[model samples]
Target: MMDALFITLQVILAVIAVYQFVFSLFGMYRKKKKAHFPATKSFAVLVAAHNEEQVVGALMENLKNLDYPKELYDVFVICDNCTDGTADIVREHGIQACVRTNTNLRGKGYAIEWMLKELWDMPRQYDAVVMFDADNLAAPNFLSEMNDDLSGGARVIQGYIDTKNPEDSWITAAYGISYWYINRLWQLSRHNVNMANFLGGTGMCFETKMLKEIGWGATSLVEDLEFTMRSVQKGIYPKFNYDAKVFDEKPLTFKASSRQRLRWMQGHFTVARRYFFPLLWQSIKERNLVKFDLALYSVNVYIVLLTFLMTAIMGIDAAVFNGPNIANIYGYLPLGLSFVAVGASILTFMAAMALEKVTFKKVYAYLILFPIYLISWYPITFYAFFTQNNKQWSHTEHTRVVRLEEVVQSKQV
Candidate 1:
């Protein structure tokens, strides 16, 4: 009976791993097709910056170059408690920019909320409200694509975010690969199947009415995720616009990466604790299994923790629990199947990378270093759980300058 129970447990985990692998494969295929939407309406481009003077100038330049009517789309920059010349730089560009300073509310979420409130009070309502970080340099046709998606009945749209500095260091390369894999496999696959896609902090466009109806307030450490969950509950699944692109810098140092990831993990945990139960209950009450599946998947940190614990327990069982005389109770079949599941997962990841137009030469270099990069996250995840860290926004420095010419050159080589 004990042997049977062990086999059953292994089978369950293998099944889950297989399911995830298949989902990733689907994403690999769906990423190749570009979904083009027609640009038909006006938009409000909103940015929240805090001590980001270095990149604000270039960001404004990128925004100014977007293929949208200057009169139809307005750029609003909220300089949240910036001690630098962030506001002055925007003014220097001869653009109409709003600068808000608040030392009390120091987070990007609060800054965005303040700006949204101010915009809401205006006599004219924009057709769509687009959100982006100050460091992000949007593609020239970003607004045009998002405008098309918005007009095509998409309540919320999420675009692809690629790293602007993949060659800077190993850390940046790993981050770039992770971002590429997510955009190609996770987001693309989920969207192809009509599953929910989460907002990626920047490069997201939302219908003005939906934004206002959802209160346009962000209080969680991960306001984007919290807002996404709330939007899902209201029957709005974020749509993925493949052609809408945003380029941003990845952390060059491990310390900076850990700090940024820790905040993200903490915010994810906080959102899970606050909303998972409520969403699960609502899904059950309304008989909407799809939403329940999304809510459960949205809080994926628990799965990682659970998998680690399970693997550790299996290791201990092999070393400490099993008697020398007793034949290994858990059959090798289950163990072998588990490894197969892992293999399939790796294949799915690689397949997704291929679909994202990642060349074999580049992927080979990343594959050799992927294990070390993945292991590094374990320490960060551990610290995120145990540390009683302040929830204050931890900013990452972005110094990389990437132009379209550089990207084109890399692609050719």
Candidate 2:
């Protein structure tokens, strides 16, 4: 019975691993046909902020200087429950700042919903709505690329997310490495195979009519994910635009990163529980492969928990329990496969770094410790599962004030 149980767990994990591995194979081929379109779509750029006085000005400057025409896009900042000078800063840039003071209805999703209603009531009509966090620095060509994508009939779009302070600390470096890996292997790979692209909280765009039709109902901690699942149910797949880039500020310390990820996982658990069955049923009813893929994607945190549980059971049984003495190599299959998975992850990280032109010397120490950061997710997943009922939103403070020019110049070096 013991041997059989071990084998069962091993097989389950192996299947999940294989599923992810197969999808990753598609990431290597990222050649997308380009459609040339005139820049005609008008965009209402929305920035949601909670006391982001320090970095909001920089983002304002970045937005003001977008390579796209000035008449084509307008910027609006939603200052939600902020006691700081964020509104003043927006006014300083001559941009309209919308303030919201609802303590009960907080979080980015609620703020977005409020702003969307306001935009809908206003006289100015926009073709599409672009969302960004106040800490982000948009690429000069960000709006132009998004315009092209909108013209190509993509109702929702997610741009490439780049790191601003990758070399700030080990934690930031690890975050940068993780984002780079997922952007290429996960997002680009899914897009390559015609799968749906998940929306990053920042760098996301939605067509005005489509968003209104879907309704701004996603108000969870991870609104981007919640909205993505909601869109998938309606057969709306967000397109990934590699040419459009947005530089995001990463937490510089482990404590900050931990808080951020815990909130994310907890929100992930909430989303999974709420949407798992609905997505699976929709997929079967409609025979939509994208919905099926999303159903699996929704339970990614549970997969992590399962991995941790299996590793613990295998280790405890082999060392402390010592109940099974099968003496067969099959008992060690999980261990062998784990080592292979780690090796593959390292290779994936190296490849991602190379593609992003990150020098080994600059990030070698952080790269060495990346596995440790990855392993930390197990405990976080467990904690998040237990505390999944807590829907309180905690803010991750972003203080790195890097300019768009500085980021672009560093990449060119």
Candidate 3:
């Protein structure tokens, strides 16, 4: 019985680790296709602001200057519970603004839901809604690419995420690496096999009708993840548009990064609690492969935690419990499996850096520290789920105001 349990433990870790290691393989075959815009489709550009006075103006200016036809899209800013000049800035730009000062409704999820409802009551509506954080600068051709995707019959689409201040600090650099890993492994990978991709909160779009029917009811700390899973379960898979880019500012400090990541972990745990089993059931019942894929993706962190926990269990059993000695060649597969994950993460980080044009000389030292940062996720993921209360939203501040021209110039140099 003891030997059997030992082998089973290694097998479990081996399976999950191998899954993650091979996951990026899906994107290896993904090819970027040039966008061909058939016609200019109308869009409602929605900016969700929360005390973002420092950078909202720049974003509005960037949106106003999109290379696409100006008449086809209108910028609408949502000043939800702002104690700053966010609303005034929006009005100054001659764009429509909605100020919601209710202390009760907060977070981007609530703000977006409120704005969608308000837009629904208007005399006219848009063909699709594009969402962005106030600190994000749209690439000049963003809407043009999205227009092409929409014209090509993509109902839900997610634009690529680029960092405006990757060199601001080590924290931001780590964030940039994580973003690249997720963009390639999950978004681009899904795009490769014609699978549905997910929205990354910002740089994502949805058809007006889809939200109306669904009601944008994703009110959580990680509402973006919630909305993505909800949409996937409903047979709506968001496609990834590589040409449409939104450059967002990353947090420059560890406190802000922890706060943001904790919110994501907690929100992801909560959404998994609500939808994991149902998604699996629906996928099987309806023969939906996308839903099956998401069912796996939703609980991935938990799966990692479980695998890690088993490794610890093996260690404890060997040391204290006097079970099978994990250090022995008899049962070292768990350790080997773990190294597989670490190696994959390191390679993927470099791959992401290469794709984002990050120089090896600037980020090589940070790459050594990258695996350590990922290992920290285990504790954060656990803390988010087991010790939970006061689900009110908390957000990271984004004041970096790097413009597209500056980023382009920096890249050229």
Q: TM per model?
A: 0.89, 0.95, 0.91
Clashes of each: 0, 0, 0
lDDT of 3 at 276: 88
Name the 10 consecutive residues with the lowest summed lDDT in model 3.
324-333
| lDDT comparison, 1 vs 2, better candidate | 2
- Candidate 2 lDDT over 286-401, as tens digits, reads 89889988998998889899878777766776798784553333455688776887788678777877775775354567777888789999999999999989988998887889
Local distance difference test values of all predictions, in order: 0.77, 0.88, 0.80
Per-residue CA lDDT of model 3 for 1-413, tens digit only, reads 75666567566666666665576778655585565865468889999999998999898888888998878899889988988888888899998878988788778998998898898888878889999999999999888888888788788899999778877777777777888777877678778888878778999888888888887988888788889888888788889987688898988887788888888887888888888899999999999888987887788767766756766777788789887654433344577765766677677767766765665344556666666667778777777777445477886787887778987776566
lDDT of 2: 0.88
**Top candidate, metric TM-score:** 2
How many residue pairs in model 3 have overlapping backbones? 0
Q: Which pairs, if any, clash in model 1? A: none
